[model samples]
Each structure stands twice: as C-alpha cells, then as structure tokens.
Target: MTSTAASRPGAEHNGFTGRYLLLLVALIWPAQLLSVTGLLAGNAQSQIAVHFHTTQIAWFVLVSSLIGAFLTPFVMRAADLFGKRRVMIVLTVLGVIGDLVSALAPNFAVLLLGRGVAGFYAPIAALVFAIARDVFPPRLVGPASGLIGGGVGLVALFGPFLSGWLLDGHGWRSAMWFLAAASAASLVLLMTVVPESPVRQERTPMDWAGGLLLGGGVSAIVYGVGRGSDWGWSSAGFLASVIGGAVAIIAFVVVEGRVAHPLYELSMLSRRRVWSVFLATALLAGTVLSAGTISQLLGLMPKIPAVSDGLGFSATKLAWIGAPASVVIILTAVATGWLARRVDSRYLLATAALFAAVGYGLTAHFHHTVPQLMTVGIVSAIGLGMIVALVPVMVIEVVSPAEQARANGLQNMLQGTLLTVVTQLFFVMMARDGRVVQGTQFYLDAGFTNAFRLAAGFAVAGLLAVALVPKLKRLEEAETGEAAR
Candidate 1:
C-alpha cells in the first residue's frame, strides 16, 4: 500500500489530494514488520540461541543482516522494474509463509531458514517512502514520510513487548505465529487497497549472478562474525566466511559496475547525500533497536520470577506492556509529521537523535526497577519514534521521483543489514561464554550505567550522522546556486 504521486493531470485538481492516505494505511503493516526483527533479537537471547546449540548470539544477528542486505536492494530493483504493488504483494505473501515456517520449525536449522526467508520479503520501510514519493508533491514528501513512519513506530511499540511476553509464557514460536497473522492481514489489506502504479517502467531481467554473489558475500561475513567466538576467529570456517564474504562483495561491485542495468546503480553510491542518509539510518536504527533488545533481556532475567515472568499473566496481557510505548510513538509520529512540514527535515532529524541519545542514556541507568524501566522506555520511545520516522523521508529528499521506490527499498535493506550485523557483534561481545546468556547479575552488581553509556555513544554517533545530512543538503544547494549563476 502506497501513495501514488499526482503525476497525471487533474489527479490533484480533483478530490485526490488526500487519496494517498488511504494507500498509506495498507503500507503500515509492512513497516510493522521492522519491529519483528527487534522482537526476535530480544526474544532470541531468551529462547532460540541455546536451543540451537549455538554458543554465540551473534549468529542470529548475522543471519538476519545477511538476508536483509541481500534481499532489500533486489526487492527494490524488482519493484522499479515490475511494479511496486506487484512486488509488494509477493513480498507480503512470502513473509506470511515465512512466519508460519518459523513458528512451526522443529529444529534450529529450520527455524533459521524460516527467519532468513522472511527477510527475503523485505519490510515496508522503503516501500512506504516510495509510495509517498509516488503519490505526493515534492514539498509534501517529507511530512508524508514522517506520517507513515509514525504509523510504523506505533507497531514497534507493541511488537517487542508482545514478543517478549509470548517468549516468556508460551515460547518464541508463538511470537512468530503472531507475525504470520500480521503478514497475512497485510497481504489482504494490500490486495484490497493498493492501486497499481500508473507510471510503470520497463522490466529488467533478474541479475542472478549479482544476487547470488551479493547474498553469498553477506552470508559469509555474517556467519564469520556470528560464529567467531564459538569457532575461533582464526579457524578455517571463520576465516572463509569473512574473507569469502568480502570477495563476494567485491565481485558484486565489479559486476554491478559492468552491467547495463545494475542491480544497484553504482552511480547512486557516488551521490554524497545518499550515503549520508544511509549511514544515519543505520546508526539511528541500531540505537533505537537497543531498546527492544534490552526490554526482552530484562523480562527474561528479572530480579524476581514474578516480575520477569509477567506476574503469571497471559502472553496477551504481557504484550500490552509495550502498548504505552506504541501509543506514544503514534502520537509523536503524527506530531513529527506536522513538525517536519514546518521545519527542515535535517533539523527534525538532529533533534530526534539528540533526544534519543539523552533518553537512552537515562533509560539505561534506571533498569533496576520496572517503573523506572517503563519511564525510560516511554522517553526512549518518543526519541526513537522521531529518529525512525525520518528514514524514508531522507530517501525522498535525496533520490529522484523515478528512483524513489528502489532507492527506498535499498535504504531499508542496508539499514536492516547493518543493524543485524551490529546486533550480532554486540551480542557476541556482551554475552557470557559466547552463549545466549543474560546479564542480570552484571546489571545488579556493576549497575545498568554501562549499557546506557554504550547506547548513548551509539546515539551520539547517530547524531553526527544526522549532522552530516545537512552538509549534503548545503552542498546540493550550493551546486544548484552555481548552476543558476
């Protein structure tokens, strides 16, 4: 579901100005899926890694990142070549099926496969932005992107708490089942509400060699980092995965540069603004994502059983723990959208990053008590909401109208990939004995201050990333000015 741009004459002149809002409703679910990755990360520390006999939590991060990196750009290009609606529907269906497979998996291998398969569908982060770019005027794009992101943040607020509760009570599998339902519903919504893009482009052939090479490269890097602690960094398996992954990426670069219609347009990478948005998006996602992971970890190993286990509440009840955060995100998202319309998006982005850093820095210190935790969560949610909402809007600002869909998709893919990779690295370093271990004692003894400090550092980096964006804008404006003269 997406807003088609008012490209055709009289489309905006008629009663169609607000029509994109209708498509945006359908777009919400895919963006909702982004929360699933966070949920999985938090829950995996409790449920999956040990069951799979993995010593390191990095594997989960690695697999998710590899899959996302491989699939996102490919899906984006596909959307451009075919049609967004067509590709979106296919992704939805595949995601639904992937969820079912993940929920019903009998073994770690199957579970991993199912989770990885879900990544292939690529979430709606990019797609929603593309839709906004398609449907709205250039001026309205920034606000529209924020509006859609706000909707997505609403989902994020609830998804993790629900996932945490389900993991605590029934098991992680139940969480997967929940996602499957959402995916199916999204599919149905798309079918009913999404309209085909009136401005379709000629189809390009699937770049099989490029896709495989890129996928293999990412998988190898993810695998190496994920299993490094368990397999030994110097071991053949680790070395091969890392070095081989790098080679694969190099191969992809060469192939893409040679191709007439590359899977990823190399020229796009040369654009300074695009890179700025990419780096900022990755950092912002990683920072806010830490919130969900911390929440799940806290639930898994509370100071007492009653608190950790939700006081014997049902999974449904526990899910509501995240509802407040979700509600705030929705409100803030709308607020941000309104604000974006008034101010430059760069300012909005920087403010969000600063607030997020402060919120995470504060939240990390108050993890000893649940009420304190809730307060932190609320503050962080507001900050996180502000940051995440800008992802697609940045894309719309940097890319041309025709390139919006693919560029947005690739943006999400890269961000998700980076987040996954970083999550794996963090887990590997943070976990005890390279296993899905909880750090309750560490938090109690050393205090939660350390984690908060680390999170704040990440947030600071994100702020810097946001600052870089404005520089790109200034550069573009200067180039335009010189051209005008």
Candidate 2:
C-alpha cells in the first residue's frame, strides 16, 4: 500500500509548472539587468574615448567577473547559513544600490566600483538554479533547470535592443537607470511571492583559504588575458599575471584536496563524468563569448564599398540581426528539457554542438550577406540554447541534491571565468592596431574572420567532449556513492 501510494501520479510524482513560471517571470527583469551591464559598458568604450577619456572595457569585464567569482561560493553558503531567501533579498538590495551608483557616477572609476558592487548579485545565478532544484521533482529537474537558465535569454532578447536605443538617445545613463528599475522590481517580487527553499541541516565550515587562492588565480588569469591585447601578449606584466594566476590555481587544487570542508571537493572533480561536463562547459562558454564578440564586430565593421558581401550595419540593425539568436535559444531551451528525458543527453549534446559548429563555419564563409548571417545565427543559437539549459542539469544529475547549490555555483563560476578570458582575448585582438575600428569596418579585417573560426573550433571541441561523456558513467555512479555518504 505504501509503495503504491508513493508511485501514484500526483504533485509528488509530477512537477510544478506554475511555480516555475512564476519564478521565471520574477527573474526575467533582474537577470536582464545584470547581463545588460556588459553590453552597456562595452558600448560606452568608444563614447568615452571620443571625449578624450579612455579605459579598457576589458578591465570592466574582468573586475565584474572577479567580484562574482570571489563572492559566489561564499554567498551560496550564506544562503545555507542565513537562509536562501534572506541572502537573496540582501543581495538584490545591494544590486539596486550598485545600479543607482553606476547610473549617476560622474567618472569612470566610480562607475567601475558601482559595476563591481552590483556584480555581487552574481551568486543569484546559483540561487535561482538551487530554487529550481528544490521546487521541482526529480523528473522535472531538466525542464526546471532549462526554465531558470533560459530566463537569461528572455532578458537578452530585449536587452541588446534597449541598450542600443538608450545609448543612442540618453547615453549609457538611461540604460543603467533602466536596469536599476528592473532590479528594484525583482526584489519586490521575490519578497512578496517567493519563499525560502527548504533547508538541509549540516555543519560545514566555509572554505576561506580555498576561495582566496582559487578566486585570485582566476582573476589574475582573466585580467591577464583581458589586458593582453593592450599590454601585448609578450609583455612582462601580461605573462606574470597569467603565470601567477596559474600558480594560485595549482595551490588551490592542492589545498582543496586536503581540506575537510572544501568549497569544491577535489574528489568530485576527479570523477571522469564531472570533468567531462566541465570541459564541455568551458568550451561552450568560450563559444558563447566568442559569438558575442563576432556580433559586436559585425556591427563595427564597414561595408565593402561596391561589393554586397560585407555589411555596413548600424548598432540597431546589428541588434536586430543578433536578436534571432536569443529567440532561437528560448525555443530550444524550452524544448531541450523534454528531449533530454527521452534521448541520451550526450547524443543530443553532440548533435547540438554540430549545429553550432556548422553555423559558425557558415558565418565564417558568408561574410557578405545579412540573410546568410541570420540563418547561421539561428543555427548556432539553437546549439547554444541547448548548452545553457542542459549543462547545469547534467551537473545535478551527476551529483546529489544536497551538493546542488555549491555545484551550481562552481559551474557558473567556471563559465564566468571562461567568458571573462574569452572577452579579454576579443578586446586584446581588436586593440592590437591601437586604432578602434568604427561602424561595421572591422569585418573587412582578417581578425574578424579569425575570431569566428576560433568560435567554430571551440564548438567542434565541445562536440568531441560530448562524444566522450557516456564513457564516464562509472564516474557518475561513484559520485553518487560519495554523495550518499
């Protein structure tokens, strides 16, 4: 009788789509505001330069990511300590203040500080996924993960367009204010509608030393890569920063291997499946950042005077061209969750990566036409869409529910770190000539095509990683055993 009742189809067996929808609705604006910061920051680079003021946009991205990397693990643990609801509320409040500062800052330095402080909400990435895991049943974890992850795409859809409009009309200040309002709304909705996730009782010390070494290492590497173009790849400063960062990371691994209450368990990382998933994540992150770079370049690169192959697109048109990518991502993200249940996720991953690879390959080849760019945009977007939705689900499946929040933080941290590095690479390569390419003109340069080629290569590498994922089943089983302890 107990077994029969447990197996019965009811709320216990099914999932809460309504709850998921409510959370998604609540998150859309906050997530959008957070993400649009980069777009606005990047757009302001040229504007700042025009007024005889200059600062590398790469620095802003680096600082922003570093703030998140250092704070995420600690913040998630705080969610456990003080309660996820309480911590989320505090973080959202801080984010609003940061946004307001960015909007009103009179100088670039103040703006950078504001942006970094606002970035404290970076842990919100893990908090959202953790909530999804808590609310949904086992069967619906994938879709729930997808909905939470895809919420970013919802924000991306309008963020780029809105950012461009604001930049054109009211300057970057308007966009910053827009995000501030969005953040305020998210805080209210979360307070009024969302409840704390049920707690798991445990006594674990926060890993302070590990966080410092690992966070510092990642920040150094990201900073080096981002500044490499400005300082030159061979410069002493760049090389030292990169090497120093690498050493810090090596130390972190050694310390984590020995720590009783490690921020991230070294044993878990050694599991073949977890590492394979991490590898795919790094590549996918690189691809996503690279694609964004390509899109920005497309807008900046000029038309091929008499030829029709190259575009001389305005920032607004560029946003329109890129908007399809976000749209396709939304559709695929929603559908991929259902597909994961029936199909081997590894197989689906391989196939999706192939789509992205083909799209990027086509993009590299068809440097001339808008229609061709749009079609390829859809292709890669579909693959990227699958990635953002599925990667975290894979992590949850590979680990236990108790480890979900920390693991989610690690996955996000890894992706953010990779994205920071990739964006830095983009900036450095663009700055090599010491002259910024203006208005669709860089597409005519060889660097633009090379960047696309590099993005395709990462997608191809991801496909290869996906092919090897099933081989890690033993690792997954072993991880489950550990989590059980």
Candidate 3:
C-alpha cells in the first residue's frame, strides 16, 4: 500500500520560511537548466537548421533525453552513496559547462555533445523530490513535493517565453548564455543553502558490472527506438539494437540476482506496492509525456502558405499560444498536489488520464485553427498538472527514506525510456506521409490526425493502468504509527 516515510523529530515544522523557499529554489534551478535548454532547441528548430546548415534539429533534444534515460539511475545512486548536496554541486558544474559549450559551439556537433551533457541535470528533479521528503515533516511532504513537481509550470511559463524572446532578439545561442549564468547562481545556492540528506545507506561495494549492463541495455533500447523511423522500423539494424538491448537487460537482471551488492533492489521493486506504481508510470508515459511533445511540434511547425496546414509561428508566438495552458497547469498542480495527501493517487491519476483522452480526441480532428488547438491544450493541461504534481509524490512515498533515491531514480529511468520511445513513435506516425519543404520536412494534416488518435489511445491505456492501482492512505497515519512505537 502507498505510504510516506515516518516524520522525524524536529522535522515537524508547521510552515515554510524564507530558508525553505530558498532551498526549494536551489533544488529546482538545476532542473530548469534542462527544461530551458530543450525548449530553446524544440521551439527554435527552424532557426537551428538555418544557423547550422543541418536538418536534424530534433536531435538536439533527443540526445539529451536518451542520456537522461541512460544515466539517471547511476547519478541517483551516487547521490545516495555520497551526499545529495555534494553530487548536486558536481551536476551544477556539469550543466554550466554544457551551457557554455552549447553557447559557444562553432558547429552543430559540439552543440549536440553539449546538450547531451546537460541531460546529466535530469536527475536533479528526482533529487529535489527526495530532498523535500527528507527535510519536510510528513504533513508537509505532499504539498512540498507538489510544488517541486509544479516547478515545470514555473519553467514552462517562462522557458518558452524567454527562449522565444532570445530566439527573436539575440538568437538561440544567447539563451544558453542565460542558462549558464543562472546555473552558476544555482550552484552557489546548492553549495550553501541546501542541506545534505540525512537518510543514509550502509557503505557497500559499488556494482559497476550491473550498472554498465543496465545503462547499456537502456541506452541501446532508447537509441534503437529513436532511430527506428529513419532506419526503417523492420530494418536489420533496428532489430539488432532492440534485441541486443533486451538481451542486455535480461542479463542485467540475472547478474543482479546473484550480486552481493545490487545496483537496484529488484526484490523491493517487485513488491505489489511498488511495481504497480512503475506500471502506472509506464502507461502514464504515453499520456502527458507523449502528447506534450506532439503538441509542441504541431504548435511550432512552419505554416506553408499554399502547401501545408501547419501553424507557422515563431517561438515567441508559440509560447503565447501555449500561455493559457501553462496557467491552468500552475493552478491544477497546486490543487492536485494538496489533494494527493487526502485522496488516493490512483483516483487522481485516473482523472488525469480521462481528461487527456478527451483533449487528444478533440485535437485529432479540430487542429487547423488557433482556437481549436488552444481549447485542446487548456483541457489537456488539467491532466498535465496532475501528472506533474502527483506522480513524483506517489513514487517517493511508496518506499522508506533510505530507498527513496533508488526508487525515484529507477522510476525516472523507466519514465525517461518510455517517454523517448513513445515520443519517437508519435514523430514516426506523423512523419509517415511528410514531404520536404525548403530542406526541411513537414507532415500532412492527415498524418497529424493519425498521431493525435494514437495519443488519445495511449491516454485510454493509462486509465486502465490506474484502475489496477490499489487505494492507499495518507502519510500522517504512517507517522502516527511510528510515534506510538
């Protein structure tokens, strides 16, 4: 059953203070580095192509997504092994380096590497969620985690606007400079403000073999799925990568079964209490994680005067178009995050899934005009806010304090892997009937319809997944029981 770590002495603060606010900001800043970087690239694909003389603009974001999927578990393990604060400092440095590299890159190759390194910042979100749980009392955990979860709304509202403004005024590289300066400031806060996590695991041998195997398997699968569209879905190369990845993952499990010190606690993960959430996570991937990217792409695609039915808006224009939805998410995320402590997460997830299905179904047919897509986006934002606010809370609450990072980290890996595959699937669906336009490709309206339909279908699948989750109680009960002992 779902539960939170029992409250510790002196951790029972009644309200947050300025120090707490500063801590949360320090925790969220590094994560925003990744978000702003991706939005910068995603919203300015056309500009990147013109500036770099290449058509593979999506790679700028995809490479980072792949690295996040591959590296997060190890990073989280390192945090638990060392200290969250120390690891966060190192990550901030890495992210700042990435920001500088991307900003000053003379060629697209260097930019790609820079973005991939920035993906190392991906684990910071999970770290923030875990840290809030560590520092806050049981009563405050849900709302605190919710705010951490809602940090996306903070970035989404501003990232697009800032990226668009920079893209319009100073060019794409200038945005990276902004991220670099912001990251440095964040680094100082992490070094000074955020406390190290108190929950610690006993020292043990590092599971290098299992880590390599797991990373390799996950990396192979993500890469194969991402490239399947261009390499032919049934091509020999695609099959080899997929098969190899599966073999490696299976072998990793075998090795974990026999290891003295496992990279992940497989026995713990397989518990019904935990595994159900992971299943829900996989299904949720197809919902918000999949549909979100599709919506962004459709919103930003260049509108061909007489050739295509795409919306030819610049980053700034697209950001304005999406502003209504961002505001809705900010409201819904706070509400759902608060509700998570009272209502069962399964119900929250179910409601979120249902809303997404309806919004995507509407998007399938009525997406030629601004009002139509805006309506779909606003409707879908309710679900987006729910997933962002509630899912992370559910993930960390299911385990004890010591296992929190590994549990959250594993979920990130699962979520990141599935997101990469599912998003690529949507890109492939729309790209099936695409045509070349001035060295770039644009999908037909019919292709977009098919992809939107598929997105709705995934939302329906998520609803089924949520139905299988058992009801759980508030964290306060768990704390009460611990106090009586």
Pairs of residues at least 3 apart in sequence or in different chains that clash in candidate 2? 229-428, 300-439, 300-440, 300-441, 301-440, 301-441, 301-442, 302-440, 302-441, 309-368
Ten contiguous residues with the weakest lDDT in model 3:
476-485
Where model 1 places Cα greater than 4 Å from the true spot, the runs are: 1-21, 44-62, 136-140, 160-171, 233-236, 302-324, 433-451, 471-485
Q: Which lDDT tens digits does candidate 3 get at residues 364-403?
A: 9988887887788888788878887877777765676767
Candidate 2 regions exceeding 4 Å error are: 1-20, 27-33, 39-52, 300-312, 433-444, 471-485
lDDT of each: 0.64, 0.68, 0.75
Q: How much does candidate 2 score in TM-score?
A: 0.86
Report the error of model 2 at residue 117, Å.
1.5
Model 1, CA-based lDDT: 0.64
Error of 1 at 375 (Å): 2.8
Ranking by lDDT: 3, 2, 1
Task: Provide the lDDT at 380 for model 2.
Answer: 82
lDDT of 1 by residue, 90-183 (tens): 8778778878888898987787788777766655567756665565434445555676677656556566566556676677677778878878
Clashing pairs in 1: 4-134, 4-135, 5-134, 5-135, 55-434
How high is the lDDT of residue 343 in model 2? Answer: 69
TM-score sort, best first: 3, 2, 1
Worst lDDT 10-window in candidate 2: 1-10
Task: Count steric clashes of candidate 3.
Answer: 1
